[model samples]
Target: MTTDQSSPISPYLTFDKKEWAKLRAETPMTLDARDLERLSGVIERVSEQEVIEVYLPLSRLLNFYVGASQALHAATSRFLGQSENKTPFIIGIAGSVAVGKSTTARVLQALLSRWTNSPRVDLVPTDGFLLPNAVLEERGIMNRKGFPESFDTRALLHFLAEVKAGRPQVKAPVYSHFHYDVLPDKTITVDRPDILIVEGLNLLQPAKLPSNGEAIPFVSDFFDFSIYIDADPELIGQWYVERFMRLRKTAFRDPAAYFYRYSKLSDDEAQATARHIWETINLANLKANILPTRQRARLILEKVQDHTVQTVHLRKI
Candidate 1:
């Protein structure tokens, strides 16, 4: 079911682009054209105006949140008579594929890092936690690549747990888009940071309660704040197809690329294949896992056909 952005009883305070832009107040725009171009996805478009209006306000809000959290930690440490250890403020960005979650995460990372309160902000994509292609194939779930069951959940949970515990250094497996798989030898080492942004398709998904009442930790358990990117599925599907077509002339042309075979296909054949994949795989994942978790986000950014955010829904505290 679609959310009622206009409902009086809604948990969120909805704001249109203009109303939301007013919230920016005095937050300065720190990103440039080169920064946006470098951080954007293959086919995603981000404008400086979007940053000034939408993201600056967001960075300002997060700066307040981080400051509050830090103060709270210091007070609690003093109360307990213990040395204070820095706990990273974890932010999660969840969305459907082709809905610009990566761009949002990267943009936020840049903005948050620029803030005096959160100069050290790290962004981690959950693609790295996905099961290796070999393991997925062995389990006969290769087609369900982005599904919750397709991830190394235990490993991801352990990493998050350690990070939240104020570990000095944590390592995450690295995945390669060109190879379309996790690299066995490569890992991204994350040092202690003031803020950590975790982005993924299923970050907000809740785990089923065990019949025996055993404790089960979900990925969302570590998130101090979460954002959901929302758009009509039809628009997302169109964007996915457009991105696929564009990849055919770029990334797919590299002989070392996993999708190189797709480069040889005609434009008509490529579009058909992209749509089929969307209908059978990506759309299914969105419906079954991603969309249902939208309300769990502390904030939701609703996008229009052109990929510009049209509405902002901030959950009432």
Candidate 2:
């Protein structure tokens, strides 16, 4: 397959899907349809064909990177005459909502765990780090939900730090879409895995400097590798609405669902609400925060319509 020369050359080396697929030769296919179905999110379509063509190669590449990291760590330890704790290789997956980042992270977790070098892989989504609904309401940023400000940035940083420091058990807060809030008393304990995948909307964002010029740490700083899923804003907006409608028919039908009211709405009314939410909140967040961080990712997956990745951009070393 020919490269898209119209795309500007940069620090990134771009490859279309056909060329990228060629790199997957000899990588074992360990996942089946049942695994893909379980990994996929509501309304998200991750086909086996797509997995073979895209994720298999990506997983193999990650395996090589992880192996190299372990080797380097060992060499450093030998030179220092002291054993360093084995830190997890953290991978950050960032993108707009409805861009299928969660699905990508899940698929990677499954694929990477199957590797002999990295047998234990954990996926922690940043949604769990989002401030509770009450906090957003008190801060008067309820309308700005999903924006970077809606998250507990300090808490997220601390959590990642502990994980990278090789903490035995790092507890992460849990968020429930059904309840539309962070579960106060509950937490997900992440043991020191061989690999950790952190997925969220703004994982690739830069740090916000203080007025006094104090340096702040970014979530991306903890990432050994990062991926940004990209698509046209218009397509993402449409996908958001489509996913909303699907949820209205499925999850919203539950009486305890946060969006239960949407399930009762007429089809047209539901569509309107979805469009309004996308345009006012999600789209705004994408433009202001998420999209700007695409260039910061180590890898970029540019998706076309039907939620398929057409090009893969790998940052040059």
Candidate 3:
């Protein structure tokens, strides 16, 4: 581990991939190729080597954090002279559109679940909280679909509040990628799990404060721990185009797909369309909203052009 030479008082301790891997320290690998295949995204690759090096140490660290949090909660309960309900440990994963937040969250959920105690872990994506297409169209902001404003932040907060309060059968709406919309009748029941992982593009976005110091609970206020996936914007753009092309061959070929119109485009046309969308929407969103919150994360996983994490900058205790 190393500290930034430029900022003598920097809050983070930096670790190269090799240095971070050493921290795995006897943490056994629990995932196979099949598990990786299931957890990864269209272009995101989660190899066994990544699991052994990057995620194992992260799992061990999170395990320790969870244990400590539980102990602290227990102590607080004791001080109050009563037993309190178990509060789920919530982790937030934030990054750009193609930054593989889902892959990372799913991998963590799997590893965390396989711990000796086998705690119940739930994974939820904020895509479910995205405003419906009709709503977006009505608001005349359909082009800003993944922007922070596109989300039903109030509903998201309510869901998190209920989950944190140990409510049973808390329902979160589901989003279908094929339809590119929130399913009206579909919901995921989150039953007071031991852990919940919330993944999104803007999970760490801060709320604007009032002059009178009013409490405005932002989405990240509910997170006990947070991670930011970092990579070059250019590389991410390339990956986005690559993923779009792949989807054109697969999902876009289905007539029911929201982006089915792009399926018939020639290679050049498809590439141009992908690039246009990336530049006009995704890239703009990243620069204005997502990238700004990178420093807010408890841990930052900086990825190389190849999409594997090359370094980790962890906020110090």
> Whose lDDT is greatest here?
3
Model 1 superposed RMSD (Cα): 2.0
lDDT of 1 at 255: 99
lDDT of 3 by residue, 99-212 (tens): 888889999999999885437999999999999999999999999989999999999999999998889999999999999999999999999898999999989999888999
Candidates in order have lDDT scores of: 0.92, 0.92, 0.93
Q: Flag clash pairs in model 1.
A: none
lDDT of 2 by residue, 1-317 (tens): 44335566667888889999999989988998899889888877779989999999999899999999888888998999987888899999999999999899999999999999999999898999999999999999999988999999999999999999899999999999899999999898999999999999999888867999887899999999999999999999989999999999999999999999999999999999999999999999999999999989999999988999999988888
**Cα error, candidate 1, residue 247 (Å):** 0.8
- Looking at model 2, residue 69 earns an lDDT score of 89
Could you arrange the candidates by TM-score from highest to lowest?
Answer: 3, 1, 2
lDDT value for candidate 1? Answer: 0.92
- Candidate 2's C-alpha runs over 4 A off are 1-9, 210-214
TM-score of 3: 0.98
Please say which candidate is ahead in lDDT: 1 or 3: 3
| Candidate number of the best TM-score | 3
lDDT per residue for candidate 1 within 1-317, as digits (tens), equals 22445675778888888888898898888999999888788887778988988899889998999999999999999999999999999999999999999999999999999988899998889999999999999999999999999999899999999889999779999989889999999988888899999999999999999999999998999999999999999999999999999988999999999999999999899999999999999999999999999999999999998888989999888
